[model samples]
Target: MFKKPLHTLKTSAPLRSSDRRKLKQRVIDAFTLDPELGDALVPEGILTIKFNTHLDEPGVAYLSPEASADPLWFSLGKGSEELIPSVYTLWKRPDLLPFLSTPPAVIPILVGGADLMIPGVVHHPSDLKEGQLVAVCQYTHRSKNGATLSVPLAVGRMAVAGDRIQDGEKGKAVFVLHVWKDFLWDMGGKPQDMPEQRPLAALVDQPESEAAEGDEEIPVDKLTITAQPAYTPAEISTLLQASLLQALSTKIPASAFPLSASVFYETYILLFRPAFPHSVLPPGAGTENSSDIGPGNPQNITIKSSAHKSLTAFLKAMDKAGLLTSKTAPKQNELLVTAVVDERHPSVAAHRGFVTLGEVEARAAKKAVNEEKKREKEEEGGRRVEVRELCKASGRTIGWVEGVGGSPKTLYEPTELRTLLNAYITDKGLVNPREQAYVNVGLDPLLLGAVVTPPKKGVPQKEVEFMKRDEVMKGLLDGMQAWYEVRVGGREVVLKKGALKPIRVEVKMRQGRKACTLVSGFEAFGEGVVDAEEMSEELRKICAGATSVSPRVGGPTGTVEVLVQGKQAKVVVDYLTEKRGVPKKWVEVVDLVGGKK
Candidate 1:
């Protein structure tokens, strides 16, 4: 059910006191947890996040008592009026759920959303009842210390009684619910990659190797071996082209002409991609290149990473190849442009049908991607939104800009605009020979036009002999239109007509001497704009405190102020501006918690 981005995240706040205490009791009761052990496992006082999965299915997760990153014991949905453990939960307490062990070769396929067949099961618990919740794990292995260890990769329910499943049974055994690459696992936050099980795959894929595998104890060391291949843009380009071609021919019909770039790639690309070639290395390189990513799995690869380099380039190449044509479309973001794909080309007969990766091959493709690309993930807040001040020459000054080897039609960055003015003065020897601080603005007609505004009416205009260098540059800048190019969170750089307003944040105490932070004037930043509720949630996450929204006292209609608990002026200022792409100067902060400015 959760194979896509959540339909909704209605409430992301920490669970209330009553709900938190109840959840703690449930964990203790279910696990038979000892008090000392339970204290660390389900830490008291620390926030226990309780939110709905996709807005309805309840989920509970606990952070580490200290220095927690990825959440542990995080699970969604309930069974028997209690929360069932997820694959993540099973990772922490592998023995919590009874398991059905299958060959490691099929574990990859099992996680690909496939129901486990009776034939695939090598070991099954005899007492399992139909519809019993069970963990699906690869065959257990011995650690170097001679201790047995099993890694559960998925969770499912038995489709049939365990006793009914035979070695050659054709019926389904485990009805898969959540797997390693599914949305649930993604929501759990993967702290580590899926563990590889090379030995089991060898025994399962080849009957001849089974006897040898049975006699030898497979060490955990053998399972950790992995393939490392750097996926180059060329191989990935082939996959991208095949996917695009497959999408054009099969996934999206000609009638669906126009779509946003995000829709085309996010929807159609994956629908037809897996069937095409997904290999990074040549054929027969073994299952070492297996990728665990499901077609529904979210990925870091974007259109920009393709061989063609960009969406526009892909379209140009498609047009060149007689595949299809595209019309200019709107941009949803810098990465997602609009597009209208027309597959009515004459050469449509030579179509390559579709691209698909089977359950096993799909993950193989992911592994190849992981090995080759290393995901090229963008770190959170890694790149700040950069705003550049720009200038475009006015009508009379256009020629002056052109004379200085600058583009009059296009905009110039502040430094570029200043450099152009300096070049004109230096080349023409307009700088005062004796007074280097001044420049002769009257030396040339173009220079005079660029360096001076027209005189007001009722007074004859006088040719200025010399002006201070800074004054001349100021006049030149005044002859141009002021513009700002704002790069907001993965969106296209936007050009605004005038200056933007600064967002104001302040910290102060309320009547009871309890501190609260107030944020205002944030609506002025486009795209980086935050609604009160959203700001409240973000603040809650950052500050681990309650937040609320109220009317901005005596402010414009429809405006609201975000109120966060405690003194959080510095963090609010950072989040509202730097994280959202607004420049630092566009935000103002004042702290009055302890009477300090």
Candidate 2:
């Protein structure tokens, strides 16, 4: 079964150019429909085709399933997408509408840029080829608040795609697809599926209205031809010079300008000029040896020589030129030599580098003398230690001690008592030096017992002196007792008594019962016992002092030891005056001094 090759339907001559132009305009109009799409078309601008289905598959058939369609791919102009939206809108025109709905699934041929292939086309238009440069109109996609639209921009091209489709009329409609050669392989569709076609130079070339004067409209060959704007030679030269200056300025100094072989030669030529000859002798001077004058006003000169010969030549030249000058030069008889001394040598201490023997001997002698003095000081210190020990043992101050034969332990050992005494003396300044010495010698004054005299044997035990009532009264009268009285009038009174009656007194001596009680009575008008006995001794003494004394007695209550007319008498009375309790008064009987009553 021989199958006929598929062929593209050709459009009639009247429809070829006009229908193609309408389709191109429709593509450009698609961009203006959306601003975001328009912005996308601007930078590195691109012609994008978002197919309803995967581009690898055949396009949808408009009327019959037998029809075939495929993918196409191309580029918009470089950095331009303006032509796409306008051209895409033209695809809906009456003349081009048939192609869109054709049974063969009319694949749109976007003149500016495209991304799909049309079936049944072999070669592109005769005026276009691959790698031929072209301009493009591209639509960009944009989204705002959920709505998406397209906008168009213009761009230039680097290469072209090779694919075509007929316009189904007389003259075959040519499809020009622009592309970047660098991106040809990854156009997202296979070459077989999305057949690409190069754009015609005539289509992208300057418009007829912009054609230069006297320029003829000539048909171009299938080989790609590009016409670029002519560049000004003067502007190019200026740019080149600026580039060279920038490069050189970065490397060379201003002082290195006007570089040329002639300038190099001329600079060296000045060095050899007789007017400025190069010489070791300074500017105003002639030959170095021409100094016919003496050691005054020396000419300036700079000599160049190798390291090994520089010094030697300098001295030789100075001599030959008669320029040797010095305030005091060395005499021929003087000898010069280098010498080194070792610091570890014994003699080295006396002489640093160079010195006279006299100086060396003097220093050595001085050192020896210092050593002897040091030894003497050490011996003296040893002797002083022995003397100090002797002082300690002998209990003497340092000055009192003599000699050096004493135990060293004795120097620090102090008698226990003496150590305590000394510590006390130091802390409290010696109150009594004699007492301090006594304490140091192990004796305390307060600890000594008092001396006693023994009593004579055979003597009757001496009677204990008892205080009689009279004697107690006499003592009270002598102001030895304290007596106070509370009178009936509420006034307090005090008195001294010369005598008091004795009373029976009992003092309990038992543990927890140490108290004294007395019972006594006093006669009043020879009747009942006077209440005076019941009163305290203090009140009795006060009353007795104020009352007249009458010698009245009563039995048992009154008993007296009396001396009448110098004779001793004992009188007993039924009534008596008695005293009890603590004695609050004293009585005194002083010898009469020439009084007779």
Candidate 3:
């Protein structure tokens, strides 16, 4: 999974006198006592620099006390320091510079997280070895006049001995641990390299590793191959030739004396290609020229060669070896392999030992089996969908409920119920004025049942007590009906014994508009069971005025608000209690006079 880059808090703290002195000594020793740097780092001296530390990184970050220095420019790590500043300032002190310089072409790849290969390395310390820390610096020509400078951009561990790297052996050289433009470098909030007028590769010479010859070429014109499979280009070219030769010698029937180039290629692809590392098609694929599709109808698998121009070259090599005879056949669009050379002949038999067909076939078989298993596993995974639980209150749907004990929750726990009650108190401002923490329940069933009602004998329910916080919360939890929610197909569905909250009513007026009555907080009313918009219209007919229904705004609970024209507060209260069977005490009316409610 990909995650967003997070900026961890970087805090500054003053170091104690003793620790400061010791760390200063270590810095001096680490930098080899550079006179200018050593003096400037001293506390309360020519420079008054402050050091800071980051929570996510291990280091003491310090800013340059010089007035001309960029405020964001800082050095990190204990004893060791990597200057997070302009690329131009990297070589300010030549005497203390770390690491041998490298060509500029490798910078982008280093930043992309690929370890440096030995062929890409130009220079390194002779004594550098595995696990040793090294810095990668590149020479950038800043001026058209050919003036160049070196700047350090990355630090990493040596994967191979430095001597081997310097010798230009073929292997991994450096494992990049950190590089410019990584998350750590983002702290400066500026480009780590000089702003490029063109792509970075075009600004420098083409990487030497990409070209067969060490010839100078424009970098942008060629696609550089940073990494290749285990086999080299030359090796793959040879293998293709050998596979064709072996297939012709072993698989062709003696009765088929004269074969066409098309037949040879088809036989090689179907019988020989699967054993190679870079085979394009799966084994047992139907021949491109054939219409039969089942397993019993084995067909030739035609594919382009992995290396450019290798197929033509391989055929020429085979012809020159006299192992096969060929002729141009324009009608079939192929070169004909007219006859098979004698297999018992010394030249043919000598080359025959090179390609171990049995071994390649066995390996290809194992790979095919693994691929089949992977396909089946992926199909099985596609069929599975995660199930979730949802919570419901009143007649309305709340949200999905995460189940406890890895099962969908069917009943609310005492603590969970208390949390809801506490929210209700806060939302309704039901706490007693005399004592802020105590809720004064005035015969409201929701509160009275929870606080006053008791569970059956030995029911393990917390005792309810007035004024006491725990007991009050316990009473609220005990009195409420037990209900839980589960989810189905991305929608929340209330399951078993659901509870509903009371409805809230209010009135308000806008400039140049009549006062409007508002009703909300009826999640227990059940979605789709009651149409708030229709109800509002019906209320308008009864009250003889305009009305509308809208979503409740600026509230913790998501519900609908029903509004009716004029002073319909008394009418709405009456209809809800008398006609709708809603508890009269549950509905609250405010600012009825002058529409301030």
Candidate 4:
């Protein structure tokens, strides 16, 4: 009875096939339905799958028997020595067995470790560390009918977290695995074969050292450190070409790649054509075709051959543009001369007085001729004569009887008398002694008397004549009128009516219009005339002052004497003389007849 109970308990507890399948389907659903579940199941030695459930709950289902068989027996969680389970062989679910039974078309593995081989990878059971596990998926090109063709290249997980692939060493081969399907399949029934591995063949195969070494290592000492080359017109053309190439090859999404290259080329041509013909490449290898030199390699050329023409052209242009200057001889001398006048010696009237006088003598001779003609007729009938005489007398008187006595005068030699007269006339006009007498001579008695008398003592005679009262008044009025005119017309006035005061009676000198003041006792008389009379009177007075006497001798015995009185006045007369005949007297004074009696 005890054996039967134990057996019954064991057999009765065993899971049914449907329930096991359901559990397996649930696990597969967990990996396929939830994207994150695939990442978590990778380390758990489990695979997830998705299923269409007839049941209400649609969720993760697990199949332990399939997950624990064969390669799974390695117990990756404990690191046991057993064959590891391939990720493709993991069961997705029990109930979804038919859908997941086929192995994946390709096993995805990260390329890593020694020599960057695919085998050195972390798969199911080991945790997928960063840069470890990756899945490569086939890339497909779709046709218009929805048919798909495999591409030579594959899309892979990058060396990043979550969907990461490992980075290989330098110069080591590396690859990433990409999966085409989204879901995992159940590992049931017969085991599936791994997919074919398609490796990428290298193009331009070269050793790492050789590719790096191909670049010329210019020894610093041997290499020329040229000045940075300036981009000239030609140089810029190459740069523009490079830019255009870069713009054309720039990655455009597949959707936009359909745009034709011709259109892009035309656009570039239109945009750069104006400057392209004149552009040049900067100095360097393959500068002439720099646009064609890709990032890979460049051709070599000499510095002179690379855009030197453009540079030379630019230098010539700079010279023509007057960007350079040099020292040169001056075109003209800097010194100059200027003329100026001497202001201090300007010409004036006084400077003209020193001119030659030949013209003055010519004028005098002409006047003499005119005067001789005027006197020619008067002198035609007159005979010229000369005379000399002498007389001496004495007188005495008593109280009752007056007695007089006289002596007969002897005649003087006429030669001595004539000689004395000629000498006197030459020196001081003429002279006649009281004892000698001459008549019909060109002399006046008043003039002779004036010369004979000694000047009175203590008397001051005026050099200039003075004006009388009426003349003074006239002059003053005229002066006042002139002052008024000048004052009214000029900028300033210097005189007033009351500026002068009278000191004495006014007297006019006959010789000039000037006037002088006389003392109270002194008297002066002349014509008293009104304005018109005054002018005529003044004229007559002028004429009288200028008159001279001419004597006539009818019978030689007759005598005449003229007395002219003035303030130190004198008179002159003209006489006619017979040639070789003698006259008794030519000049005599009656007042001196008795000889100072």
lDDT of 2 by residue, 1-597 (tens): 001111111221122444334434444364323333222222121222321111111111011011111112122323333342122222111111111111111122231133222222222333434444332322111111111111111112223343323322222222233222212212222223322221222323436774453223333343221111222322222222222222222233334533332232122211121211111112223434333211111000111111112323333332243322212125643221111123332333332222222232233334333443453445333222110001122222211112222242333322332343345434434234544323221122211110011137976543322333233223222322222221111212222222233332222222353322222322211111123322333333443322122233353535321111210001111112122112212211222222211
Using TM-score, rank the candidates from best to worst: 1, 3, 4, 2
By TM-score, who's the top model here? 1
Writing each residue's lDDT as its tens digit, candidate 4 over 1-597 gives 000001111111223556544433443453232434333333333333322211111223232234332212111113222221223332321111111000111222111101112212211111233443223322111111211212111222223332232223122122222112211122233344534322111111334674464322223232111123333334543443343333323232334322222333233222322222212333444444544322210111111223433323322332243321122224532211111112222221112121111122232233333333343333322212221122111111011011112122322233333353345443543323442333212253322221222236876533322222233223222222111101111212123212221112112243364322111110011011011222223323533532221231241232221212232111111111121111213322122222311
Top model by lDDT, which number?
1
Write candidate 1's Cα lDDT for 144-172 as tens digits.
22112256878778999877875335567
Q: In model 1, where do residues sit more than 4 Å from their true spots?
A: 1-378, 403-405, 453-463, 488-493, 508-515, 521-534, 549-561, 574-586, 591-597
Q: What are the per-residue Cα lDDT tens digits for candidate 3 across 116-166?
A: 666555445566667665666664322232313354666666887755653
RMSD list, candidates in order: 27.2, 61.1, 21.0, 67.7
Between candidates 3 and 4, the TM-score winner: 3
Model 4 residue 491 lDDT?
19
TM-score of each: 0.39, 0.13, 0.30, 0.15
By summed lDDT, which 10 consecutive residues of candidate 3 come out lowest? 293-302
lDDT of each: 0.60, 0.24, 0.48, 0.25
User: Deviation in angstroms for 459 in model 3?
Assistant: 7.5
State candidate 3's TM-score. Answer: 0.30
